[model samples]
Target: MNYKLLGKSGLAVSELCLGTMTFGNTTNEADAIEMIDRFVDRGGNFLDTADVYVSGRSEEIVGKAIKKRRSDIVLATKVRMTTSSNINGVGLSRKHILDGVEASLKRLQTDYIDLYQVHVWDHATPIEETLRTLDDLVTSGKVRYIGCSNFFAWQLMKSLAYSDASRYVRFVSIQPQYSLVSRQMDREMLSLCLEEKVGIIPWAPLGGGFLTGRYTRDEPKEGRMTTKVGESAWINRASDQNFSILDAVVEAAKELDKTPAQIALRWLIQREGITSPIFGASKLEQFEDNMGALGWEMPTEIWNRLNSASALQDDYPNRFIEKFRRPFE
Candidate 1:
């Protein structure tokens, strides 16, 4: 139930954010409402949804669920995905951002968004155009902060540089897919966020349920891995290395008498520079299990064990640069 300042901003948010991507989809409206209630009862006040989630149904459900305590919640949502048949319905162009924010505000039943993020990089639009539009949102009181998701290190740096030079509102947070099984961020994005002072609210902090100890190496279950066929496909994430990391998590769970899901989440919560890890559930039980990730600290030995199991191999400039470091006298 601890709070942290989001990036370098004065805004304080809970260490764990409730993700509503499954609301009105796998989870019905009633269950979603209950989950939000429990989350708030447990001292959580951050909620994340995207306009594109379930064709905006998720936003609608979240809007209804939090109507009573709107002032106490930090709401975040994203744009930049195809929302309609119109040719100008997508991307970070000024047209789309302006249109998207208006639509998001209506669906969320809120006058302003706590954080409005571009879901991904829009190469078609000039960075300046996107930055200016986001700046306008802040200026107009429609958005309090801006952020980006699924961006490369260079893309984020480019946006930050543009914001600094143009005197625009800089991105204060980033939402990346990070977990024990997905350490790709460790390669570059991690260092970039650490240096830039940007908060990281990691999506899929449990590797789309991979680190939840629900799946086996040889048998894929009836969850996203078996049903969805995208970047999170079983073929893509069921590699030997990832299984080893899962094994470590399972071992830690057994030793500590906690679920593998909690172990995996605690690992991310303890990682330096992680602001909050967004977790969602289709059932109330799943949400309750994830809540176990809080209330206790993971022992250093278990944390190190998971870290070593999932550490990515050093490559190129990182390895080469490490050899030249000199000890301070």
Candidate 2:
């Protein structure tokens, strides 16, 4: 239930952010509302949703759920996806951003968004054009902060540099897919965010339920991985390396008398530069299990074990650079 300042901003948010991507899809409105209530009762203050989630139904459900305590919540949503049939319906162009924000505000039933992020990079539009539009949103009091998701290290650095030189509002945070099984961020994005002082609110912090101990080596017959699509596909998550990492999590859970979900989440919570890990639950029991990640600290020994098990393979210039630094150390 602890709070941390998001990036370099004065805004404080909970250690865990509730993700509502499944709301209005796998979870109904009543259940979604109940989940929000329980989360707030447990002292959580961050909620993340995207306008494209479930064709805006997720935003509607979240809007209704948080209506009573709007002032106490830090709401975040994204744009930059195809939302209409028209040719100008997508991308970070000024037209799309302006239209998207208006639509998001209406659906969330809020006058201003706590954080408005571009869901992904829009190469079609000039970076300056995209940043200028976001700057206008802040200037008009429609958005308090801006951020990006699914961006490469260079894309983020380019945006930050443009903002600094143009005197525009810089992105204060980023949302990347990071977890014990998905440590690709460790390659470059992690260092970039750390050096730039940008907060990281990781999505899929449990690897889309891979680290939850629900699947086996035989392959999942059902659940998200069975779809064989996106990052959570059976092909992507069924690798031998990921299973070894999951074994480590399961072993830690057994030793500590905690659930596998808790062990995985705690590792992320304690990792340096991780502001908050966004977790989504389709059921109350799942949400409760994720909550267990709080209220206790994982022993450093176990933490190091999980870290070593999931560490990314050494590659390229980084290995060469490290070899050179060993003598100096």
Candidate 3:
């Protein structure tokens, strides 16, 4: 497995990070352990979880799975997703940040988190308060690095500028939903991260299994995309545009003799500024299939074909600026 430096940090992480969101949920303890073992055996050292996943059972399962090799793993988790009903139980306030980390550390059975991220933006709290609290976590050695997730371009920049001016630890990475069907990140977040040097760790890299090619246009598939028995699911992702992207992935997979999921994941792995893609699986076989995304490069022609199929349309100022970009170029 090839590793990349996470943003400007010296720490190196695997290209594909094992996501534990399904752990202790659809994935049983035995299956979760098997998947974790196989991932580590295959040279994967990065794992991601969160306090809010399965109401904290996911973190407990992950902690038990990696306790023996804890030192060798780059474990990451998040906060600010309403872990409790208390008035001060959530958000990025200094009180919540401190309380959240203490609980996360205890559940993960680790002294320090490799990377602690805010799960989402909290507009109620001041950005300064959150940045300072995260800096204090780094100062106290409770967190090795800080990151933000699901933040808009302006929110992220505001936090970074505050960190720089206040001389606090800045966010080194971002976790956003990015995949063949979900190119929304490309609209603005992608370029912002590239210019700011923040590593992009894409979550739902397979479009929540839409790009896996298991679900059909008419027939529902047996996967996470399902809502209930005999229930059509992921209707929002069933647009004609996404079908075209899926067909493109299938064509590339056929030529490469790989699965659609692997090709789709490889597309993200090859994108600029992407540090890693957090992939999850309920069964060991699924884990094995996704791990195949590594150890090879996609052919340029096929890569471009998939890229063209999933290209995002420029809007407003982007279209306006592109007309004048040639002068600067």
Compare the candidates by lDDT and give the number of the best one: 2
Kindly list the per-residue Cα lDDT of model 3 for residues 120-239, writing each as its tens digit: 999999999999899999999999999999999999999999999999999999998888888888888898888889999999998888888887787465666666422125666778
* TM-scores for every predicted model: 0.98, 0.98, 0.96
Pairwise lDDT winner, candidates 1 and 3 = 1
Worst 10 residues of 2 by lDDT: 320-329
Model 3 ranges off by over 4 Å: 219-222, 228-233
- How many steric overlaps are in each model, in order? 0, 0, 0
Could you give candidate 2's per-residue lDDT for residues 100-197 as a string of tens digits?
A: 99999999999999999999999899999999999999999999999999999999999999999999999999999999999899999999989999
lDDT tens readout by residue for model 1, 207-245: 998889989987575788885577679988899999988
RMSD to truth, every model: 1.0, 1.0, 2.1
Q: Would you give me the overall lDDT of model 1? A: 0.93
